[model samples]
Target: MVVSARITNFLAYSSLTVSRVSHLGNGSLRYQWLLCRNTSLLQLRSKIQTVVPSITSNVSVPKENIPTADALVRPDLEGLYEDIREGLTNTQPELRQIAQYYFNGEGKAIRPVITMCMARAINYHLDQNAPGVIQKQKKIAQIAEMIHTASLVHDDVIDVADSRRSRPSVNILWGQKKSIIAGDFILAMASGMLARLQNQQVIILLSQVLADLVQGEFMQLGARENKDERFAHYSEKTFKKTASLIAYSCQAVSVLSGADSTLQSIAFQYGRQLGMAFQLVDDLLDFIATSAQVGKPVAADLRLGLATAPVLFAAQKFSELNPLIMRRFQEPGDAETAFRLVLRSDGLQRTKELARQYCNDAVTQVAQLTPSPYQQALVTLAHQLLHRMK
Candidate 1:
């Protein structure tokens, strides 16, 4: 039987598939992952073309050759930080500083970039000769940044993180109490901006993201005993925490473009898939990336006693990890042991494979739209997320 190109490449790269790998004597799992890192460019190009023909006929082009989604949003994002700062300004100088801390143009602004790209793509889909992005669409991008940054501030407080993007966290500079208030302030401003859109449906859609963020945090604080249920819980939390904002922002842009329900749903699906892919890559990075590379602590999830995708996948091969996961990895050496075991297992590889699946789905979703540069950018953006180092 002919296997799908995705599965073929995935299986070909590793000497042992997950099912075939098991513990050998001396309690060590025996596996070798000889991936295509050393493959010639021509070979990689051929493989990508086979796996995702829908995105491009001639694939595996050098990074320079791909249409960069970042370029598409550069002009619009130029003044984004300034606009956010203006909105977050407060009478009290210290409060204003705290509220506007993350708007200093240091972060990647991935959410806004995705929102702007989706908005333009939806606009062009509805009208082949549509003008540049409308004011309301741009507002959505700004609101997305604010919502995302606000979450980061609150998360720093909860995670007790001292650094973010390689800089001191808000909670570290301003006490935890003040950081929480500053985060709330940013959210309030974002809410006001969202309301100004004057589209009741858009208002409701974006509002749901706020609720999802809170609920996701609550879910992250605990673990389930059942393996099946634990994975489900993790999936739900991932969606609520990361995908909710992106999915709704894309849908709101479609609605603002006057696209019908079908188009709106299409936009939502694309963003949902892309967002999930982005988070999976992030989770994988937590285990593999250095502090300088990720701009934060390495293995942060494990340090926080959170069992992310890599740890969960590793647990399947090592039953010892189950108790550690349930106890939140609080015991001495638990985090270190789990981290080492995950690296030895195929957990990181499996996470990357799952991320590729979501990225593929995202590409497929965006392809349904009328062909345009903006639409193509969306597809490229999904692929970029799958391979991003940070």
Candidate 2:
């Protein structure tokens, strides 16, 4: 779904890029067709002209060129999706409510599903006859999700988001004070769940992850105005806010199941890369995805004064975009203009490339593990992560 002005221009001026367009996921391709179909080439050109005002003409699109939905949904992800849903449902009632409201609705549950898949990958490799492996893996998956859910509750309060997953946010439904308490409650529950495992290593790992998560959020808030700051701030925030939990989630299962250090490290690295890629794609989607598709308003991050990877990348090219970004898109119509400028620039492409790199790194890390159906599933999951539209 990541497209640059260059690509749009290419599509407008010539039919060449249409054929070269890659299908990352079925949802995105389907969405693309929906957008392209709802507006004819002439109408699309007109819209583009309204925004850019410089583009003068329309382009043609062959009806048969668009890919179908059947091509995108690999059978493997279906089971992972089911397992995640089941895991969330089986948790405590309050936790389950939180999961149902936030996790089930807003998120794709990519991280926890990947955690379970990777754990199963290593588990199946170690001992096919092992007892309780599935149960253990499921519990680990739940814990990962709990951490994520807890963060989201807090995030809604922090961001002052009114809606999530197309519904009233936890803060909106239960007030900010209760929302903060609920977030802390989930964190406490997650901590207790990890403590019950009594694995010093896993407990330490998750504890550090919580710290990193807070630090990342703090850093992001502090660096909101510094457009010239190294992309490392974004990178670090991504790690703490997104990657660390995923990395630990996978690694914890390895330690719980007594995998070798090398395998455990590989799992952690795989999760880290995948998590970073997930956040990058999320940032990309904020600009490109619709309110319905993304489960939140388009450009919500920019509207909230948060500068993500795409905005950061775009700011590098359009220096004038900084004041708008720094001022939290305070000016009237600033977000719309900023969005158009980024779409027109190389920022989207750069962001996609960065996400692709992380996906590649994740694939490489998981490739180190011995080949099995589960390993293949993990690899497929990694590929699926980069291409996800919603």
Candidate 3:
């Protein structure tokens, strides 16, 4: 029942966002209702002031109990890359290089680290005295990273992005066709690795991530003309593309660890919330960070004609953005004008505030577990995500 409720809450938000676009003009009561229904920025501001304190009050875990961010990824950092490389060894040399290109130990492997952290923490939660990560759990971590990297490769092709992580993208080096093949190849290898896990339930759970990735890309290719519906559209896309993998990956590990349905739901909820927050931060970084800082071009979303959280939030204050969003900033200076408007408005700050809520919610969900270093690391990591520059 709890699982059903959580899943419903997750989908309800999506449904609200993608609802039919009302044709009523701006000043009508019905129009106002639709606009405010998804919690307008004004409402969010009030909620943030009141809700954050209440939420933080529920977090009983102490600061001293949490582990450092370094402690979270350091243990498995070296072995994770090696294992991922080993997974790629059976493929052809060129495919192997393209598939393994982004695994160069530079970027922070946040997904796998979160997976392993959840695995160990859940392991400890189930057995307070037995707090070690099992072999199968490690495989899940590797699979998560592989799936993530594969998505990045495909995304670069779709976005026609030339750079990633301060290096030339796979699409740039290998061309779009081979870059796509490379992405597919990495996914195939990850699938094979998943099959060896031999857990039908876990396999099904992780497999859904592949479908979500495709669905998200489809959502990105289109735009919502209705201002009321755009934020919901963005949220849904963010979940399908970014959050589903983390949510399902965390849930898969929970299933592997023999967690009860309730515990598994908690893991999924944590990952769902954290994944949304992570992407929100990424969207914010696109607006505020430099090309060198984020290792990718700034304003990439705007250039791609996509309206992310920041742009969506900024739209509320600037009606000029409505047509720009509808047409996807295709006009000369549309992207530039929209970018300036977003900065002038409170979009960046509101986006940050919303992300902080999701991050706090992640911390709250993980705090339900039995207190342990691994659990504490998960909590600490959630907080640290807000401050990340890249």
Candidate 4:
């Protein structure tokens, strides 16, 4: 039997069919993935086609292809340090210490990197920032990282997590209450900085991202009884919990550059889709990756009773999972049972397709912007996400 699916809701619509077979270089199965491209995605697919396989290390990243991390962040590195230090500051030394607990200089900084590049790319003066605006845009990047770290601190408390980025989480290093306060302090600092930016629109945009984060957390705490509502709820929650900051950060930089609404929306759209795609990949990782790779335990989401994209898609064919999802997998053996079912089903494959669809939208969104190596790096970044096994 053959199964085909459309992961349209995430972005573009296209039915993909995967057949059981031999092998596809990197993995066990000889899957087409078709890696099918709908007409809407073709332009995007073609643009980044070369970069995808290379960044995936099917080949090398080569010297002259796109902007590297240094190429993008080096110029603004000193300012990022100043801005991040400023956000973590407090007169009370202990409070300041707790606030800076996660700033160990090991973060991937994907959000800030994207924001910095987007700021430069969207500026009317291509390949450069508009004088005073360059400094402000770098602040936006700094703020993005600060706000993201703040959320992670709170999330560790929320998830009762002990480790992040392969180290003891803030909640583990400090106590939960202290961790919570630190998270709040960081947020307050970020808010004060946001106010100082003095762009009401920027404040409103980032502020809304804050609200979405709350709503997304609440959504994660419960599951909808209806199948359709469950999927819709999960999608929105994914955006709120994962994508909002990335979306608004992109839009905020566009705003900083004095781009019009249409352009700002395009930037937001790119980030919104990219952020969701990022989380979907994370959800998928919970099942497929090892604890060592993800810097946490495997099946973390399922163990926590969260039905992510994989479980939801698996439920479409495995009736047993529907009841399990509704009950939050509280039954004695529910998580393991659901885990076994997902492993045997096409859920992983389908989820990958869904994520790819979003990346396609991400690529398309940025395609409209002025072309530069930075812009190409953005596209390269989206494709690189597909290859992140961890």
lDDT of 1 by residue, 150-172 (tens): 88888888877667766777887
Ten-residue segment with the worst summed lDDT in candidate 3? 21-30
Top candidate (TM-score): 1
Model 3, position 139: C-alpha lDDT score: 83
* Residue 155 displacement (Å), model 3: 0.9
User: Which sections of candidate 3 miss by over 4 Å?
Assistant: 1-66, 69-73, 128-133
Error of 4 at 387 (Å): 0.4
- Model 4: CA > 4 A from native: 1-64, 79-82, 124-128
Candidate 4 global CA lDDT score: 0.70
lDDT of 3: 0.73
Q: How many backbone overlaps does candidate 4 show?
A: 0
Q: Write the per-residue lDDT of candidate 2 for residues 213-259, one digit (tens) a residue.
A: 78877776676645544365556666877788888888988877789
TM-score each candidate.
0.83, 0.74, 0.82, 0.83
**On a 0 to 100 scale, what is the lDDT of residue 236 in model 4?**
69
Off by over 4 Å in 1: 1-63, 128-133
Every candidate's CA RMSD: 9.5, 9.8, 9.4, 10.3
Query: Pairs clashing in candidate 4?
Result: none
Clashes of each: 0, 0, 1, 0
